[model samples]
Target: MKKLPIILSLLFLTLCCVSCKVGRFVYYNLANITDYKIFPSRPLVNDSIVFHYYTTEQDKAKVPKKINYNGSEVAFDDFLADNKTVAFLIIKNDTIQYEKYFNGYEQESIIASFSMAKSVTSILIGCALDDGFIKSVDEPVVNYVPELKDNGLEKVTIKHLLQMSSGIKCEESYINPFGDAATYYYGTDLRKALSKMKPEREPGTEFSYSSCDTQLLGLVLERSLKGETITEYLDEKIWKPLGMEYDASWSLDREKNGLEKTFCCINARARDFSKIGRLYLNKGNWNGKQIVSENWVEESTKPDTGLGNVDYYKYQWWLSSGGSYMAKGLLGQFIYVYPSKDLIIVRLGKNYGEVAWPELLTSLAENY
Candidate 1:
C-alpha cells in the first residue's frame, strides 16, 4: 500500500497548486474592491514641496440638482447615490468652487486612479523628451528597449505606444483570469510577461486601447532614465515642482524594485489630483514653471494622426467635444480639464452609470 502515500502526496500537491492559482486570481480580480484596504504601493514623496492650498470660497457656487442625459434629465444626487461616487471636486480660476465626499471618504482619503495613470505615464514621457533623455517620439521603441529588437515591435515608435496604436496582441479582458491584462497586472516579472507579446499588425497603422502599450512605454522610460525609478523621476520632475500637497502612491507588480503598473493604479488625494488637471489646463505650466513643454502638451492632446477616427484618443488623454480633454480611469475616476474656461474637475468614484460626463462638464463650465 506504499503507492497510496505517493498518490495522496501527488493529489495534495495538485490541490495546493490549484488553490494558489485560484487565490491569486481572486485577489487580483477583486483589487478594485480590496486594494484600497491592502496592496503594496510605492510613495511619491512630496519632499520640500510647498502645499498650494485652494482658496476656500465654497459658498459662492451652486451644485446643479439635475443634468440632462440622452435627452432626459438625471438627478445629480441620484447619479451619485447609484454610482458609488466617493469624491468630486471642482476648481476654477485657481480656487475650489465645489467639493464633496461620500461613502465615508474624506479630503485625506487616497483614491485609486486606475487607467488615469496612463496619462501620467505619458506626461513622464514628455518630461523625458523635454530633458533630451528621449531624442524623439518618432524614434523606434527598440532604441530604448533593445530586447524588443528583432521582434515584431522593431518598428513601433514611442508615439505609437502613447497613442495606443501599437497593435500589440495583448487582450485587455479584465474578466478573464488568464488574460494579458491580468498577467501584467498581477504578474511579478514585467519583462518576462512582456517578452511573450507579439505584434498583431503594423505599428502606427491602427488604434486599439491596450494597457500593455502603456506598460511598454513605462519600460521605455525605465530604460531611458538609466536606473532611475519612475516614482523618483515623477517626484523630482513633476510632483515636487508642481507642489503636490500629500505624498502619493503607485502600485507595483511586486514588492521592492518591482515595476509600477503604469497603465493603472496611482493613489492620491482628490485635491492633489486637481493640480494635474490645472497643469494641463495651463498648458503644462505650473505657476510660470514649464513642467512639461507647451508644444508637447499641445501635440499630445491633439489628434494629429487620422487613425482610430482620431476623435477621442490622443497620447493617452481622451479628447472630447468643445476642446475639452481628460484623463479617465476604468471605474469613473476622471481629471477633466477645460482649458478654455480655465476649469479643472476631479471625480473619484466606483461607477459612472449613464451620466453623460461631457454634457455634465459642459453644463458645469457654462454655469460657473
Candidate 2:
C-alpha cells in the first residue's frame, strides 16, 4: 500500500494547484482599502475645499437665451429614461438656463468624473506653463519625473502623454473583470501600478488610450514643484483661486496624493464644475486674474501634432469639429463647452457605458 502515499500527495498537489489559481483571480480582482466606497459623499466646503456659488443678482443675469433647435423633446426624454443620467446642466452664453439632477442626485451631490479628470489635468498643465513652473509641453516627461528616466517610457514626452499617445500598451475596459484598467484599480498603489507596463510603440506615433500615461503625468506633477503634491498645487492654483463653492474630493493613491493627471474623480457642485469651463471659455482669465495663460489655453484646445485626428484629441482635452470641447468621463460624465455659443453643459450619469452619448450630442448640436 505504498501507492497510498503517492495518491494522497497527488490529491494534495491538485488541491494546491486549484487554490493557487483561485488566489490569483482574487489578487486580480481585489482592491486594497486606503479608502473606498460605492457612492461616497464629498467633503464639506471649508478652507481646504470651496465652491463657487452664483449670487441672486448674478443668477438673474446669467440665465441662458432660448434657442431654436431641431431635436425632439421625446428623444431627450427617452435618453434620460433609458440612460442613468443623474445630473444634466446646460449653460448658454455663460448662463445656466437648463440644469437638472436625477437618480436621487441634488445640487451639491458629488459624482465621480472618471476620465473627465484628464481635462482638469490639461488645465493644471496650462497653469503650470503660464506660471513658468513648466517650460513647455514638448519637454521630455523624464525632465519632471526623473524616476522614469531609465525606463523605456523615458521616450514619452509631456505632449505625447497628454494626447494619449505615450506608446504604452494598455487595455481600458472597466466592465471586464480581468482587464488592465480594472487590475490597476485593485492594486494597493495605483501610481506604482503604471511603472510595470512596457512601451509598445514610438511615442506620439498612434492613438492608444492608456490610464498609465496620465498616472505618469501625475508622477511628473508630484515631482515638478519639489515635495508639493498634485492636490495641493491644484487647490492653490486652480480650485481655490476659482472660488469653488464645494469641497471636492479626489481618490488617492497609497501615497495619499491626488491622482490629478487622469481618471478624474473630483466631486463638486454642478455650478462649480461649470466655473472651470467658464475659466477656459475666457481663455484662462478669471476675474482679472490670469490663472493660466491665454497662449496656453489656445494651445491646449488646438489639435495635437501626432497621428490622431486633431479634432478628436487636443492637449488631453477632446475637441469636436464644431469648435466645441469636452471633459468626457466614463459612464456619461461630461462637461461640454462651445466657445462660439458661450455654452457649457455638464452631465453626470451611468448611461455612458450602455447609451449613445454621441447621438445625443448630435441631436443637441443640430437642435441648439
Candidate with the greatest TM-score versus the true structure: 1
Model 1 lDDT per residue over 80-137, tens place:
6566888888787887777888777888888888888999999999999999999999
Q: Candidate 1: lDDT over CA atoms?
A: 0.80
- What CA RMSD would you report for each candidate? 4.1, 6.7
For model 2 the local lDDT of residue 273 reads: 75
**Each prediction's whole-model lDDT (CA):** 0.80, 0.66
- Which pairs of residues collide in model 1? none
Mind giving the per-residue lDDT tens digits that candidate 2 earns over 79-129? 564567777777776555667677677787766677777888778777777
After superposing all C-alphas onto the true structure, candidate 2 shows an RMSD in angstroms of 6.7
- Provide the lDDT at 201 for model 1: 90
Q: Against the hidden true structure, what lDDT does model 2 obtain?
A: 0.66
